[model samples]
Target: MTKEKFKSLMQEAGIKSKKELAELMGLHYGTINNWGNTQGYPTYLNNYFHFIIKAKKYDEALKKGFDESEKPQECPSNVEALSLENARLREECEKYEALKRALKEALR
Candidate 1:
C-alpha cells in the first residue's frame, strides 16, 4: 500500500496519526513511515492487523453495550422490564455488527 493509504487505514481504525500508530504498535515513530512506503509493511503488520480488527470489534461491542444501558424504558413488572432490556441489548449487539461492517466498507 502507498504511505497515504496505510495512514488512511490507521486513521479509520481510530489511530489518528503516525505517532499514535507507533505508540499502539510499540514501534518507533519513523518505522510507521517506512512501513507505509514499503512492500514488507503488510507482512510485518499481518498479525497486528488481526489484533487491530479484533480490537475494533471489541470496541463496537462495548459501545453497543453502553448505548443499551443508556436507554430508558419502563415496564409494568420487573420480569417484563428485564426481558425488554435483554431484547434491547440483543438489538444493540446486532447494530454494532452492522456498524462495524459499514466502517469496513467506508475504509475500503
Candidate 2:
C-alpha cells in the first residue's frame, strides 16, 4: 500500500501514531520510522489493510454497545426523568382543573 494509505489504515484501526502503533505491535519505534522513510510497510503491516477494516468495525461495535450506532443516544437520568414526569403531571392537573371549572359552569 502507499505510505499515506498505510498511515490512514493505522489511524482508522485506532493506532493514532507510529509510536503507539509500535507499542501495540510490540515493535521498536525506529522500525516504523524506517518504514515511513522508505515509504513502505513490512509484510505484516502491509497485509493488515483488511484487518484494519475489521478492526474499525469492531471498534465501532464496542463503542456502540447495545445501542448499535456510532453516536450514543442521550437517555435521561433519574433526576431528569422525574422532572419530565412532574411537568406531565402538572399539565394533567391543569387540564383536570379546567374540566372541573367547565362542569361547574354547566351546572350553574
Candidate 3:
C-alpha cells in the first residue's frame, strides 16, 4: 500500500497520526514512520486498515441500535447475516424487558 493510502485509511478509521496508529497496532512509532521511507507498507497492512475501518463503522452502527436500514449493502453475506441477527437479538431484548416490566406491575 502506498503511504498516502495508508494515511487515508488511518484517517478513515479515526486515527489521527502515525503515533496513534502505531499505539493501536502495538508497533513502534518508528516502524510506522519507516513505511514511508522504506519500500512501502506491507501488503497485509492494507487489509488490516480496511478491517479497522469496517470495524469502526460496525461499532458506530451498533451504538446506534444496529438498525437494519443503516446496514451497509456492500457488506459480505456473513456480515449482513450477523447484522440481521443483532437486530433480531435487540428486538428480543426489548420484548423481554417489556414483559418483565408488565410482570412486575402485575405482581405489585
What TM-score would every model get versus the actual structure? Answer: 0.50, 0.50, 0.58
lDDT of 1 by residue, 14-98 (tens): 7777788788878888877667455347665655655787899899988875574465442235669788999999999999999
Whole-structure CA lDDT of model 2: 0.77
Instruction: State how far residue 49 of model 3 sits from its true place (Å).
Output: 0.7
Which residue ranges in model 2 land beyond 4 Å of their true spot? Answer: 62-65, 68-108
Q: List the residue pairs that clash in candidate 1.
A: none
Compose the digit string of candidate 3's lDDT tens values, residues 8-95: 8888888998899889989999998899796577878888988998999889878776455666554567788999999999999999
Model 2, span 2-100: residue lDDT tens: 688877887667777889877877889888788857656677776665687797898777766646254344433555888999999999999999999
Q: Give the count of colliding residue pairs in each prediction.
A: 0, 0, 0
